[model samples]
Target: MDHYAFTLVNGVFEDKVRTDPNNRKPPTLIRQPQLGLKSYFDGTSNPCDKNIPQPWDRLRDYVDVLNRESNEGAKYKVIFVLRHGYSLHNYIEKGVKKVNEAGEEVKNDWRKGLKFAYQKEVSLEALRGAGCEIPRVLEDHLREGDPNAAARVSLYDAALLPKEIALQIRGSEVTNNDAEGLGEQWLRWVAEDEFPLPGAIYTSPLRRCLETTKKVYGPVFAANPKKHKFQPIIMENLREKGNGDACNYRSTTKYILDKYPNYMPEPDFTESDEYEYQIQRAENGEPTESDEELEERMRKVLKDIFDDDKTSVVSLTTHSFSIGALTKVLGNARILDEGDITAFLVKAVPL
Candidate 1:
């Protein structure tokens, strides 16, 4: 599979070939983004999952300063856990891996994700809105493209960046869509059922998470200017676990600030902390933290935040490793969708 890139060209989004990963040359035709989030990532183990951990169990993981309050001082604080929207890397990952209906790893049907991805979930509105033209040679991969495979018209933003753009092209496997139902489900809970508006958001310092934050909640915050736009704090701990190229790569601070001016970056934020993350992954070629280490970190981050934060509701956006790790500590695992947002109602007992 070719490593194609999507970039903004004079306010329009364009797709072109990017054969190498480490190439630092400036893009010739478009304003190539320095962020890895802008590029499609390569292969991985398995790629499709959309379920989440049970809310109550996750809530129970919250702790009190001491159990001295007769168990009444311990409980959960309301929170939302979400995954990043689909990415070019995700397109690459899902384009190759294969899983069963239950979303379990089946085999190396690597070619499956490729076909499905090329045949990205189709809708006329999305296609017509795609601002750029699809070359005839590339049209063979698309069902909607003309016979000559020459969708040779100018591809536009609306089409290139579809509202459903967050979702990966799944063809018949709309189960990902079913799993992604949390977006609407969360809205229904908030609007009709009267759920609390998010007080703040803490997300992985990845481009996709930031993008997802805007797409999923931007409209709500836009309507209510008083909340200061619920600026998401870029929490480093929330990034996906790994020392590999995919996990460690990040857009520069200038890049991120330019792309998302509204987001509140941590005072100490940096672009790529590859050295630090490599330290986290291992030392002297030996594995660093086992399950216990990850659990400890997960516990510490969640507990410290709950104790310090007075807000009624918060949200965390990051990758599956972090999500699944927390799920295992709390209970079992449910593969959450790329853009899914699931809520948990937690009440902290007074210390």
Candidate 2:
């Protein structure tokens, strides 16, 4: 069987590892963590707590064990590490309200127009003006003792409050349009007629990542209806930093920046209690593992995947820090700087 793996890392694929089965014991396949555990975003100060080892850490452990087990002349290999694609929320951010030089709050054009139209059409003055233009119609519409006129007036008044508020609220435009466009280009390149290999796909559970996967795989699946069915495995651990807190809108980089501007250069991952605990352990020469330890962990994970002789191909979909950390650990510090679609190929024999 042809083994191929493609991982989405830091908005692109950084490496691809493959191996052909040979005259050796088949390597064990390492199972990735469940999607639910990977995606959980508890907002404790240190998100990487004792109860929650970082995803990278878990991946590393798996790799280390695999390497140790395959010391008996087994071949190990790995392929493509990648980052998830742009998200819907990224687009939404572009449309948030911003103050112009005049200090006037100007919302997105669409929101502004919607607000203005709602206000103008529902104003008491508007109805009065309409009455003057259609006196006979108003008289005919409102019977001598009917309450329709008063009801209409009350409805207009009620709408006025919300309409005024909505005018102040800003609207958003698409933010990651460029990123998505680039992603599409990369997908096309990989699926060319002469493309080298068959590949598997994986991704983080975030909307942006899924959207990217869909865009990239849609055409492939269309062209090869039976051959290229994109099976995306959503790994929660691959999500962006602060995913959990950001989802609640209570504690996020944006929320913190808006609320506590003075805390610039936000504290390291150790700013959280869980991280602090790990730091304390490290200080004592007994480091506790946490998400902050993703880089080191990913190395082992990759190594383990490589050592698995049975699996020749695989792919991962992760995020920026995780991708950078993993690539750095894999002796390719410069890979972090490579643009989207960066790919690496590695071949190793049992040591």
Candidate 3:
């Protein structure tokens, strides 16, 4: 496989939008097409420029120019990376138990959530003493009390919380009232801004991501009658950084196909979670799929996208950990909130 250096095209967004974690504002491009300021690709006061109706068109034209002027083995693409909506794993990560559809707490202790034990402050020795894995830990007491209990297993390929189904659906609605133009309603603004529809969509195989991709993009593609069909390809490497948690674990390819009959997974996709049973961590300073490994995996996926898809715009429905690696691979550090949709230009140069 080859590697590419991914560079972000800056000055197209507000400084705080990507740089400031404290900025609670959702980074939607509808209202601020050029971020309410002149972009590096701002149009000149010419007749052609004056005729353009939207700033997004100018931005698209700029990306075209960038690709045209770039050297060989280099291209510019606009990618909209959307984090999956709030999931059961997210709720459990905050130490909350699973809730039933009737708004009552699920007393099934076996369905408890997992923690990021590897990233926790505790030392590895301490974790080992407690027979802990990076993302999944079998506490000594639990092991001693009941070795085969359901709680021993973390969330199995976590699904979205019930309320998020409504949240994302509502967010997708277009609003005619300007007063209702808040950031949380991202899809509305996306439609308003005339953001280019993704020529290709690549999603993680996790249930939450699969569900988010369908719910979010189904309407997006439906509204555009002439656009390509809403056919998302489930790529295995697009999964989150594995932490040995069942949430990061994915379902079998057949199971996914049965659930989402329309999804076209990679030809070689297997019937089981390929990476679920692998060693998630390295000891004695050995190499593992932690920091560098995650970046490398993201690079391969990006390379595949660049090589296989000729689309100017691409969409990805993934998780925060995967996005973290992706942004790093793209030379970005911005983090996305749950259900947040962000777009940026990527300059990929083969290395």
Candidate 4:
């Protein structure tokens, strides 16, 4: 399937905020000049320039027209893709310290508390049996008589830190049209009508993505109970590209379903990590999932959505790498920052 991306604030449309050399930042709703200026499909025929009272209404009508006129084999879908809020893994990866809610520095750095990570449910005993070298941090924890210290250090399928949860709360406010002074709010731009509600919602089964999706859409679901009868569908393919990183490795289906009992899992969803990490590289090469594999997984997921869903508007909550691969599969290029939201007008061409 091919796609065309437009009207993007953080994705393709670059601006001073995103390009500032002194303090480069992601395109956030709180940032000024949100959503960019009203753009036109053609240079002359701006939809908002028409007699339409609301810019969003004009844009919606334009999209409706495009879908209404397109051939049956080629249908346009407005995919609202959002990268999940920063996870603990992200915090560790950046190796930056920030004051947390407790006013204490959140972990000195990734190396401070983290020596290495183990796949979900993999115990220190198992790793030791596999001849994995125990990190000093883990050894210190174990020496302290803490049995669960390895689990804490591993942080398998990382969860969002408190700051990221706060970020999601702010992001949700914008989604619910609660931004009063945060500059141009895209959801508010369609104040004449409720911004097009996502007909279907999908999310990575990873804990952080699921948590972020819930946090961001909690109000939306509450406001439009009829539109969102169920929680977002958990999709394995929406998971981040695997490089043998514990954070990229998702939890088991049982674990996820236990947390999100109402969320739908695809029929083929496996109870355990379908793609487990290969500890012995000699036999299986590197455990990392290649970019080509990631793109193919993305393509398969897109095809599944297009085939099963009739909704024109769909929403996805996933990781940065997953979103990047998805865009690549759709013939666009975007590497969304953590917690950033962007949309793409994708046309699924039956191949």
TM per model? 0.56, 0.39, 0.70, 0.68
Which stretches of candidate 2 lie above 4 Å from their native place? 1-78, 88-187, 190-193, 241-244, 247-292, 307-311, 334-339, 348-351
User: Per-residue alpha-carbon lDDT of model 1 for 1-351, expressed as tens digits?
Assistant: 111111111111122322313342222111122211112211112211213142222222221222223254453444567777555445434432322322323212322222221232433233333322222332433434356443332211101123343333544544433223445544554455444566778877777677777766766666557744657787767766553323334566777778878787766677656434453423232234455666555555576566666665678887656776654444433335555554433333343
**What TM-score number comes out for model 2?**
0.39
Cα-lDDT of candidate 2: 0.36
By lDDT: ranked, best first: 3, 4, 1, 2
lDDT of candidate 3 at residue 66, scale 0 to 100: 67
- The true-structure Cα RMSD of candidate 3 reads 10.1
Model 4 deviation from the true structure expressed as Cα RMSD, one decimal place: 8.5
How well is each residue in 1-351 modelled by candidate 2, as lDDT tens digits?
113232322211222322224422212112122211232332212132335244433333433344456444433233545544433222222223221221223333433333322231233344433221213323333333463554232211111111112223312422222334534554454454223222456554444445455555556555666655555554434444432222211123344335333223212312222321222222222223444566545654455455432444466555555665655554554222111333443434433
Question: Which candidate leads the pack in lDDT?
Answer: 3
Task: Point out the worst 10-residue segment of candidate 3 by lDDT.
Answer: 174-183
Q: How much is the lDDT of residue 253 in candidate 1?
A: 70
Superposed model 3: Cα runs more than 4 Å off: 15-51, 96-154, 164-187, 280-288
Model 4, stretches more than 4 Å misplaced?
Answer: 1-40, 43-49, 96-115, 118-152, 164-193, 277-287
Show pairs that collide, candidate 3.
none
Say which prediction, candidate 2 or candidate 3, comes out ahead on TM-score.
3
Q: What is the C-alpha RMSD of each candidate to the true structure, in Å?
A: 17.1, 20.9, 10.1, 8.5
**How high is the CA lDDT of each candidate model?**
0.46, 0.36, 0.63, 0.59
Overall local distance difference test of candidate 1: 0.46
